[model samples]
Target chain A: MDRTAPLPLALLRGTATVLPRAVISAITAALLRGLLKTHPRLLENLTRLEPAIVHVIASDLPYRFAITVGRAPITLTVVDRIATGADAQVSASVATLVDLLEGRIDSDTLFFRRDLRIAGNTAVVVGLRNVLDREELSIANELEALCGPLGGTARRLARALEVIADSAGARLAAMHRTLHPPGTEAQDLTADVRRCHEEIAALTARLGTLESRRKRQADKIA
Target chain B: MSIRYLELVCPAGTPSALRTAVEAGADTVYCGFRDCTNARNYPGLNFDFDELCAGVTYAHARDCKVLVAINTFPRAGDESPWHRAVDHAAAAGVDAVILADLGVLDYATRCHPNLRRHLSVQASAANAPSIQFYRDHFDVRRVVLPRVLSVEAVAELIAETGIETEVFAFGSVGPMSEGRCYLSSYLTGLSPTSEGACAPASHVAYEEIDGRVLSRLGGVTLNCFARGEPAAYPTPCKGRYVTHGQASYLFEEPVGLNAIEILPQLKGAGVTALKIEGRQRSRAYVAEVVTTFRRALDALERCDEGTPTGQLHGNTEGGKETCGAYQKGWR
Candidate 1:
């Protein structure tokens, strides 16, 4: 993970850092259980990745997780550090990791944007990614199921917190833009360049259609 | 209204993706084994023997065919793995075995004479004589055309050779040379030909330095993207390197081949199958690409004229798509 990489989950990261280890353990256990229940082949598929221990680092938080892929029942434990050597390590912000787990954003897209970092045994990491990606997961669904009667309240609270965080992010961006007028102009130019690409694509498609039609007409004439 | 449109052959790296493609209207779903037997041999991706069997049953029940790609060349004196892949795929009752290796093709021809064989693009048989050689030698029922051919060239080759032709409809256009690319091997010591993966994700890394993202393969910097710019894969061919203190892509740019707009031309060019290439992609990608092409093909079957362009740009690499060489728009 890049030290200079800006992590946007400030409110969540602050909250997670202050939390006790016991609470983190409990939440981790429940989330793992939820994943197992939701994805039936989770254990079976992971067991194939024998001897590949995956170290997952939430770069913005104080916690890291070690998931032993080859172990039956799939042991994913939350620890303050990577206690043992790992075959592969994946590092990303808490927000990005959550979005990835819940299938909110595509993994390759994140990889292309350099938002997430993957290292070590290519096969092991790729296997872990594929196994996880095979399932359609949702943190909201897991939260709802993890808590019994308080599930609704938890969901609503989480939703409210997300809204608040987003609003804060937007306002911060606006303020930053107000302070930095040069960036705003650059952003506008980027938008214009994107529009040009779209225009070229549309024109290319139209021309290709006409070419195809002309070829068919040429065949008819022959 | 019995308009026979081209068959939609979709890629599935996993058994789950295979089922998704089948459900999403793929006429045929192609996949490789979990190892280096098939080209998309990425980590944690592809199907095991049992999974392949189940996938075959699932696709067969839905009238969707399954093609096993054992396309990678067998290493000298280490041919058993590739040979067994063909045997297993044949026993698994796959609709066909897509093969490119000459020795493996011969083995399949001699041992499993009943098995159907499709000439993989890895064969790089572009000309009519090359196609005829594969067809006559291995009894190849179809040939996946390389991405470099124009529609006229494709139509001419098909007319001359008279065999089933499959053209890439969407996916990353590997450096124009199909089977002979060793650029990744030069950098990573792992060959896509022998390993079935180009620029394997294991050897790839992305580093952020001074507010720019540097995509590297085998510790060699491939491409650097500015913030807010669409990024490309870290394959050797797409690298932007400096010669005279100015960096630019030498071989090709980082644009994906999108043949959706030119599907009508492809069909008219005597293309038998339209291959959507991305087995290593997630099921979400499989479903989305397959569904989009399915609708377009169905509409084409009904003589509807709307283009299937731009709808797939969301998932395309570099946020940009090209008609590839199908139109040769530059020429």
Candidate 2:
């Protein structure tokens, strides 16, 4: 057996490139939905905990994924959609995760060598690694080799699935609105410092008001 | 009683404290760089590159080991500085580099296989599997347990993994999981877990209204204290809040974790080291805390179970301290 065989391009690009952000985002939602469908224990844990905020900052991608878990059970909120600054994030490609899951590459060594980093919910991340790191997935890699690249029709079909599951585009727009609110002083140092002082003063005044109210309430209760 | 040789791990936020802790009898001293690469990335606290080398030398001469904590999670697409920190810590001949991020751990393992690795409390590797996972992969030597566990739980963990464990003994106690908190980022657009400061002085607001004090962080009111009340720092999780139309401390009350009383139980639990948690503190505070722990450890070593001790009650936040989850069921 060729244990050192190269990975299928589909396994490689499917996660990072072939699947558009919208599609991958949708698939993430669907995959999570599927997991919740069968795993009663996990569902109970999540429900008891209300939800877990996932802050996925992919090191190989030009975006960050942030989602409020309590509100949307099946939504992927992608933020900073486009790569702008030199410090823009890059998410791990599908190929890399597949290679990692298949034991073809050591995830720790790769990450240490500056090859991988999947941030957010380190514990849940351990669960995700467990799900993907299956011997069966390695066998599927060979099957993927035979299936070649998905044709245009198949890509369109996958895109349609993505469109149905992914609420990323709308969420991205909302995040932009909140992050770059108009009229807030931009990153100008002078303006930011002044704004900072004003914010501090405002908070101080608010604290005083709350203190008076709390004291009055305590007095009345006593 | 079977003797437990508990190692007194102390903080040396500055070079002076490094020397002070060693002279005062600290078994190991942990410090960090003068940047956000470490959790204690306070201004004027951490060591400069040259100072780090010198501090390591200073501690080594006194038979004390120095550990560099580069514990913050790296920013997206900008991991060069964290990598450089690990490389520098290794090159400086420090005893170990305490790390949290898996990427940093991976880098350190491959780049400096000879460099010792200790799990930062920030990883929150509370369970046996997580600890074993790190040990199996990164070959981590020790893990600093989060403040959430009880002494019994700590004992169970030590029994399960047989891995050296460090638990926080004193300092400002964080309510939420370290390195995983996002409340500040959600409210203030800055995070302590990532930014190395919480309710950062930049966003915090303090105002006196009608002789009462109110504290706010990122526009969210944390607490309102009367004139005589001691005002706690306005962190998001530890602050007072309005929930279900009721105004109170929803997540946690205003207090800090003080496990100084549970020193014996911690030793009994097979914990190899006891960490003192303050890095953004004054050198005076470091001296007092380190000296107290050093003496207590010595007494415990001598099996003087009824040893008289000096009081550090005034040094604790809220002027009081609890054994945290070690004794009481804190859920």
Candidate 3:
């Protein structure tokens, strides 16, 4: 169990890359179609904006997706190669994108943090962001709908797996910290000096109180 | 003792929000279609045709009135959408269609003669002559008064026009005349009057620079909030700018119009309805505001004095509230 266990990046990349491009594209198209069906305003808004090519790239993986808007029935496609001249290009980690789809993180905050990169046509990007923010989107719910009767069971199993993975990761990090300490001598010394100063202050305050009490007794005796 | 309860007009951004307002004791709930015909033409907001129909049915079942806001000004060549929205609203059996444009009102008057029309606040018909013109020409039954008018002025207008008047009781206070502000359009090339969205979400962006959050509309910085301070809607009018080496809210400060404590004064001013103005907000917000106002109105009807003031501090913009023009004279 190592804290420096490299985030299983290879495993994630392998899983993403092994999936067929057609399958991924089909899934994305189907999910977006379902979203439009539930929320028709999304398509209507896209139609309002000028026609543009938006390329969405997963920064941590070799995956790129493009959506062409400015027409009725917006289209989504998976591009095998990076787009060279997209009207707007949005790049983020797959996890961040998932969080966005789930409405778990604020897109503006991500953009501000530079975790979500947008280039080229900013108006289109802003339009897309606004449209997306107007609704509560959940990819898991769409997938569950596709699964029918087994959806509940699948969701429960997924939750259990997530819990197990989180606990396992936390335990591994704790063990790693025990093996390799923070090793900051200066910080420790600073803490010690701070404690000593606090003690001295307290003792001086106590001495003042004692002197006041002794002066009262002396005054009474005189 | 029989007391007339002030009609509580609330905003419903979605179907659920409409239902929430009704359940929370809204006398009337106003909403718009999912297009530029309404002032709150934000994405994923407002109702579609089916949703609007269902909402009307739902509100009717609950004995609550549904007002459809087709409040935006029609574009030069494209008046079809606004006309269709009025037709749809009438076809859906709404109690009233709130309108701002002159041409749209004429169309509504001619095509749907039986339908009720209310002049939208966007019309900014502050004076008696302007309001009388709408009532005389288009047969507008009600006029949602602009926030610019004082309570006394509102009472005077109502007395002069003898038409039903609705004043803003809660929500963002706009300094400029409604339906005429071009600040957003100047920066974004989209007209607030035509697009029905001021500071259209498509043109708004927020960035954190040196621990300060800067809210921009189409590349122009509108407002900057220090860390841990509450942020407001990114409208150009409420932006803080540098003037004479001092950065201050030049046009207007961010404060919500709250007439909760002055409910009696507004009711006394002969206001037919008190409008709560947050259609783009969530149902939770709708529920909270509607519920608080419902209680205050109930208490007022019971002849109780001293309405609560700080009940809505948390919900207000920048966590501050003011009676706005209603009490501006006192200051």
Docking quality (DockQ) of candidate 2:
0.01
Error of 2 at B7 (Å): 1.1
Off by over 4 Å in 2: A1-222, B1-4, B244-246
In order, candidate lDDTs are 0.83, 0.68, 0.81
Output the TM-score of candidate 2: 0.58
Sliding window of 10 residues with minimal summed lDDT for model 3 chain A: A1-10
Tell me the deviation in Å of residue A182 in model 3: 24
Candidate 3: where are CA atoms >4 Å away? A1-222, B1-4, B303-311
DockQ-best of 1 and 2: 1
RMSD of every candidate to native, in Å, equals: 13.0, 24.1, 7.7
Candidate 2, lDDT over the whole model: 0.68
Clashing pairs in 3: none
Ten-residue region with minimum lDDT total, candidate 2 chain B: B278-287
RMSD of 2: 24.1
**Model 1, range A72-111, lDDT digits (tens) per residue?**
7677778766455877788888888976664455667666
**How displaced is residue B274 in candidate 1, in Å?**
0.6
Q: Evaluate model 1: give its TM-score.
A: 0.80
Better of 2 and 3 by lDDT: 3
- Candidate 1 - chain A - TM: 0.66
